[model samples]
Target: MKDFPAQYDLQDEDVLYFPHIPKTAGMTFRTILEDQFHNDDVCPATLNAQLKDYSQADYEKYRLFRGHINYVDIPQILSHKHLLLVTVLREPVARVISHYEYIRRMPGDPHYDMVKDMTLEEFAQGMPVGRLGKNVQTYYIAKLAQFDLNHLSPDEVFDLAKKQLDRLAFVGILERFQDSLFLLSYIFGWKPIINTRRENAAKDKKSKEEIPPSTIELIKQNSLLDIDLYQYAKELFETRFAEMQRDLLTKYGAFTHPQTVKEPMSSQVTQELLERHAEQRFLNLNPDISNSLSYDFVEPLRGTGWHRRESLNDRSGYRWIGPETSATLDFPVASDEDVIIEIKTICNYATTPDVAASLTLDVNGHPVQLEILYSDRGSSVRWFRAIVPKVALDNGRVFSRLTFRVNRVVSFTEVNPLNPDPRVVGIAVNSLKIFPVHAAKTESAALSVFELKSWRDVATFLEKHLGPGDKIAAPLVFQLKLPNEVLDYQTAFLSKVDFQWLILYKGTIENLNPILFNLLIHRFSPVFADGNFVVFTRQKQLPKLSFLALHVRALYEDRIKVPIKLYIIRQLKQIKSLFVRRSKQAETD
Candidate 1:
C-alpha cells in the first residue's frame, strides 16, 4: 500500500490515506478518522482536481488525507508523506445495488442523469458506471500492482488484489461495522470519537430480499472478482480480529466475574453541581447531548446495538441496549487521572433472580472496578459506579472506549409468554456522566489496614501523601485481608479525602473495636463532619457484629451532623462462623 517498507514504517509515513470506494461506508469512516486530527490537518482532496489545489507543503501539513480518490493517484497527490492506507469494503452485490440506489437519490453523482430512469436490472446489465460498476473493490486493490488492468489475466488481477489487501494498514467490512471500528481503534492506538450516524444512506432503497432473484444473479455475475476479493478480505478480517480479541481477553482476563460499581454519582443535586462545574463531562441522553459536547466525550459509538431514546413516565429519556453482548461508549481523558463514571440503567427484563444481569466494564483492554451504589429491583432501576484508574486510561487520547459487557441478555418473550417483544435486551441506560477524580492533596489522609510490605513502599506512600509539616500520625495499625489490586485503587480514591476514614479489622475485633470506635467519635466530633468507614474481614459479620451497635451509637450520639457510610467486603463461611461466636461471647459478657 503506498510503497512503504515491509514492516509498518512510521518515520516517514505521517499520513493516513483512506480510499473512499462508493457505497462501502467509507464516508462514515472518514468522518470518524477526521475527528482524530485538527480540521486543517485533513486534506480537502476528494477528486483529482481537488488534489491540484494543494501543494506538497499543503499535503505534509495534513494528518489525514481521504476522499473518493483513486488508489493509483494517492502516491503523487500525497508525495511528501509516506502513507498508511485504510479502506472499507462491502459485499459486492449489495454494494452494487447500494451504488445504483445512491446514484438515483443523489443528483451530484456523475452518472446520476444516466441512471435516473434505469431500473436495478438495467443498471446491473448495462454496467454504465465503468470500473466502479464491476468488481470495484478488486479494481482498487489490483491497481496497486499494475496501472493497466488490460495487461493482467482475470486470475492474475484477483491474486494481485489479495496480495495488496494484506499490506494495507486496515480493511473494514461494512457488515461488521461496529467490530471494524473497535478493531481500528486497537490497531491504530486511536481513541475513537465514534459517530454512529450513517451519512448519505440511500433513502427508500428496497431491501436486498425484495430484489428479484434474477436481478441479484445478474449483479452477482458482474461482481465475481469482487466477491472473491471480499471473501479473502472477510477471512483476513476475522483472523486479525480474532487475534486482537485473544490478546485482549488474555491480558485483561474474562469479564465473567463482575465487580459492582461502588460509588454511584446519581444524586440530582450533585449531578447538577457537576454539570454546572464541568458541563462538558455530562452527556444527558434525554436531550441527546452526545453530538453537542465540545470534546465529544462519552458518546455511544455503535448505533446498531441500541434502541432509540425513549421516555418512561417521569424519566425523559433512556435507551435499551440489546442484540449485542457489549455496548461501547467513547471516553476521552484529559490527563492520567482516575475517572469516575456513573450510569443510570434498568435491568427490567432480568426480573427473576435466576436471570439477573451483571455488567463488566473495561477501558483500553484493562478492566476497571465497578460497584452498585443504588438499586431498587422493584423499580427496576440501578445506578452503577465505576472507577477507571489512571492505570487503565490512556491519557491525552482522542478517546478511549468504555465497553460494558453483560453476562446474559433476556428477551421479553422469554421473560413472559404473552409478551410479543422478542428483542434480547441488556440494560436500559438512562444517562452517563464522567469526570476526573481530582486528588486534592491539601485535604487528605491515609488509613491503612496493614503495614506496607517494606520501607520502600512506605517511602513511596510518604512521598505521595506528605507535605512540608505533615507527620505520619503514628501508624494506626490493624490487619485486613484484601487483594493488592483492590487496595491500590481504593486507597487512591481515599488519598484526597477531607472526611474521616475509619478502618475496621474483624479478626482483632475485641482488641481494636474500642480504639476504632473512640477514633470514629473523635473524627466525627466536628459540628459538620461526614466520612466513610470500611470493614475488611473474611466474613459477612457487619450484620451480626457487636460493632454494629457501636456504629449505630456513633450516629445517635448527636455529635455528628453528616452521614457515615460503611463499605464491607464479602464474607467467607468460616469467617462468618468465627464472627458469630465472637458476637455471642460479647453478648454473654
Candidate 2:
C-alpha cells in the first residue's frame, strides 16, 4: 500500500476516501466518489471493514475478477496509487455534539440520557469504555482515537493532521464541503456529481427556550481537541484548494467546455420526430456554455453593453431589496412620560452576548433621551428578540426626529461575534413596531408547550405541518421533553410522527446537518403517507419508540421542567396542611 503511489499517476488515480468514522463527512465523500467513478476502472471499499478481509485469497480472486481494487484504510493506509486520502475533520465541540446526537438516537440504548447528568469530560472518558453502550460509544471512541490525539497534546492534533496529509495525495476539509468535493474530483480524475443532495437532513424546528450557556461552554471545552484538528484541517485544505485551482487552470487552459453545434429547429417540428431519430440530440451538450467562454467572446461583449445579459450575471435579481420610500416620525415626551423603543438584532457570531442597543431621542429638536436595553443573543447567523417597555414613546413638543443608534461594540472578544460593528444606533423608528402588552391569565399559559411522546407522534406532526410553502424556525423546534425528574436521561419516547418528520426533512448524508445544530443523528428509512413526501432517520432499521423508551428511562430517571419543581413543592405543602386540618376537625367531632 505504501508504494502504490509510485506506479500510478497518483494525481489521476481513484481517490481513497477516508472520512473519519462518525463524521458525516464519510457519507458525503462516499456519495461523491460513487457519483464520480460510476463507471471508472476503480473499486471502492470501506476501511470500516478490516484490511484482513481484502488480504484473504477469496478477496484477491474477487478483485482479479473485477479487474481493479482500491482499498480505503484509516490511520496507516497510504500508497502512490491513491490519488487522494481525504478526511473531513470537524471541531471537537462539533464532533462531540454529533457523537451525542448519534448516541441519543441509538435503539434499545438506555444510557442515552446519562449524558445530561455527566460533564462532557466524563462523557468523553466514558465513551472509550462503552459506558453508554459497547456498540455506540466504543465505535466513536475508536474513531476519535484513530488520530492518536490522546497520546499527543491538543496542538499535536494539527501536527498529526499535517502528517496525515503528507501521506495523502490531497486533503479536503469538511467545513468547505463543496469546495473540497470539487478539489477531490479535479485531483482524482473523477467526474463531479452535478446536483447531489444530502441523504438525511434534519428538519429545523423553532425552540422558544434557549439552552443553558454552561452546557454550551462545556461542549466547547470538551471539543477543544476537535477545534485544533478543524483549524489545522481548514488551513491545510484552503492552501491545497488554492494550489489545486491554480494547477487546474494552468494545465487545462482556463477550464472551458468544448464548443457544440446549435442548429435552430423549425417551430413546427413535432416532438415525436425528434425522438424517432436516434442520431438527433435535442438539448445542448454544453449546459454551462456561458461559464466556459473564451476571452475573445467575453471581452468584446463587456464593452458593447451586452453585460446586461441574464446569463452574464445569473444572480442579479436573487435578493430582496427594500423600496426607496421613507417615513418620518415625531414624538414628544412629558417629564412624567418615559419612552421605550423595541429593537431586534441579528447575532451572526460564535459567542452569544448580552448585546445592548443605544437610543438618541430629541426633545425640542435637541438630543435628550439616551437609553440602552440589554438583549439576549443566540448562536445562529440570525437572532431576533422583541423588546417590551414599561413606558410609551410619548414625549414633549409634539414632534422631534428620534434617532436610534446601535452600539456596534461587542462585550466578549475571545470568540467571533456575529455583528462586530453594528450599523443602526439606538432604535430606528422604521425598524420598531409598537404593540400593546396583555397580561397572561396564568403562569402555565406563559410557558411554551413541548410534548414528548414517541418518535411516531413527532413524525406525524411534522408531515402535517411541513408543506410546500411553510417556514420552520431554527435551533430545532423539538425538545426531548423528558420527565422533570429524569433530566439526565438520554433516551426518551419521541412522537412517531416527529421522528418520521425529522427523517423526511433531513435528506441523505450529502446534506447532513452541521454538527452544532444536530441533537440526534440516527440512520433509518423515511416513509411517506401521501405517497409523495418522504421521511427517514440515520438508523438503517426502524425500531419501536417504546423499546427505545426503556433506554430513555434508564438515562433519565424522571422528566424535568424549568418551573415544575417549585410549583409542585408549593402544592404538596398546601395539600399536607389541608389534610392535617381535616383530621383535627374529625377528632373534635
Candidate 3:
C-alpha cells in the first residue's frame, strides 16, 4: 500500500474537490458535487468505487497525503491552462486551537491522554515547533513556528503568502465562505451549493463564542504574517466582488435566483447588450496604440562635453578661461569679427568692503571696450557684472576664443561671516545664452537645464534611465555633484528623495557628527551682497523663484526643509534691496 501511488484519475468532465481540512462540511461538499453532476445512467459506478477505495485506505496514511497536497510537492494533476486551484484560508490561530481541541477529544488516540490532561500552554511548549510540526500550542504560535519558526521572520511569511497567491489561480477567505463558494462555482461552471455543517449552520456562533482579547492580541502579534496576507486578500476580494456586482447589475437590472420565475427581457436591456457588443467589436477592430507615441528621454551626451578628454587639465583654482570653455560655447565665428563677452560675479559675505576693478577682453590681439552693468558690495560679499564689446577674431569660419585679463586686484575683509568652506573666491558661469544676429533676423537658443528634486530622486531617476538595457542617456544639462551617502539612499525610488536626505542629515546631526551636514549647508548657502543682490545656483532647476523667496511662509504651508526655507527668505530680502539700488543706478547712468 505504501509503494502503490494512489490516483484519482478524474475525467475532463469530473470535478476534483481537494479539501485540506476535513470535517462534516467537507464530506457534504464532496457529496453535493457527486450528486449534482453524476447522472445515474452516465457514470454512477466510477465515482462510488473511488469513494469506497479512499475510505478503505488507512486514515493516518491518507492524512499524510492530505498534508502533502497543500505543499509545493503536490503533483500537477490539472494542466496549467485548465487548472483553477482554489483554497479557503481560516485565521491560523483559531484553526490550530480548534484542531488541537478536536484531536484531544478523539476516542482512544495515543496522545489523547497526554493532551487531554495538559493545559494548552504546556502542550504547545512541549511540541517540536515550526512549520510541518503539529499544533501542540495555540494556533498563532503553531502558525509562526510552522512557516518560519526561529529562522524566518514574520514579514517573510507575509511575503511568501503573497507570492503563493500570485502563483496560484484562486484563493478564498473562510470568513466569506458563501461568497467564496459562489466565486468557486462561477469559475468551475457549476451551480453554487452551500455545505451545511456545525460551523456554517451555527449562525450565532460568533456572538456565543467570543475569542478572548488576550488570545486575539497574541494572534495579532504572532501571526503578523497572516494579517498582511488577510489584508491583501480582503482588498482583492472587495475589488473583484465590486466588479462582479457591477457586471451583474448591468446585465440583469439586479441579480436574482436563476430558478425563480424568469422575467421577459426588456427592449432597453437588449439595446444595452447590443451596445456592449458594438463597443467590444470596435475595440477588437482597433490596433493597440499604447506601444506607439510613447516618448522616452534618450542619451544626448554621446560625443559631447561629458566624454573623458585625456589632455584636459584638472586644475583646482581660478584658472584662466581657455579654449575648452570657448569650444563648449560655439563662439567667435569666422570673417575677422570681434565678439562681446560679459561676466557676473556673485558673492555672499557681510563686512566685505566693496572694491572696483578693471577687466579686459581680447581676441586675436584686438582690444575691446568694457562697461560695468551692475556692481554691489556688502559686508559678506560683493557682486560685479562687466561686459566687453567688439573683440577681434580670425578670418573665415574659424572658432576663436576670448580671454579676460584682470588689471587691478580688489581685496575685501571677510568679517562676521558664516565661514562657509572653500573661502577661496572662484567664478562659475552658471549659464551662457548666445543671441546670433544674422543681418536683421535674430535667433536665440538656451542650454537645457536639469534640476534635481532631492538628491534621492535624482539617484533613482538616474538608475532607471541608466540601468542596463535602458537606452536613456545622461541629461545634456549641468549635473550636480552630491555626496556618496546622498546617492546611496535615493537610487531606488523618486518619492523617497527628500525624505532620505532629511533623514540622513538629521541622523548625522543627532549623532553629533555635524561636519558633513554643516559643510554641505555652507557650500550651498545663498549669497547676498549688502542686502542688495542675492545670487545662488542649485544642482537642480527650482520650480518657482517666488516660492523660494517666500521660503518661510512656504515651509509652514508646504512643509519644506527648515534650512532651505531660512536660506530662501534671507536671500529674498537682499534681492529686494538690490532691485531698489539697480533702479537708482540706472537713473544716474
Q: For every model shown, what is its TM-score relative to the native structure?
A: 0.46, 0.33, 0.31
lDDT of 3 by residue, 1-589 (tens): 1111111122353323233442213332333333223222121222222333333222212211111123221223322313323345555555545544654667564457667776444443444533311321222222322433346554554454465555333445667665655444433333233433222222222321465666545544544554566566667665554444454345544323334312333333422332333233333444342211111011110011111111112221111221122212223233322222434323322212222233354544455554332232331111222222333444222233444444322222244345542122212222222222221112111111113234344434334323233221111111122222222222312333321122121111011123224324534332211111222223233322342454323322332355557879999999999999999999999
Q: Rate the local accuracy (lDDT) of all candidates.
A: 0.56, 0.34, 0.33
> Candidate 2: lDDT of 288?
27
Cα lDDT, model 2, residue 313? 34
Q: Pick the candidate with the highest TM-score.
A: 1
- In terms of lDDT, model 3 sits at 0.33
lDDT of 1 by residue, 5-90 (tens): 32232333578878788888877677677645544556767775677666667667777778776744665555566667788989
Clashing pairs in 1: 191-399, 260-370, 260-371, 261-370, 261-371, 261-372, 262-371
Instruction: Write the residue-wise lDDT of candidate 2 on 117-187 in tens digits.
Output: 65544665555431231122122323322533346543444444445545555455555666665555444
| Poorest 10 consecutive residues by lDDT, candidate 1 | 440-449
lDDT of 1 at 31: 67
Q: In model 3, how large is the Cα lDDT of residue 187? A: 38
Candidate 3, poorest ten consecutive residues by summed lDDT? 294-303
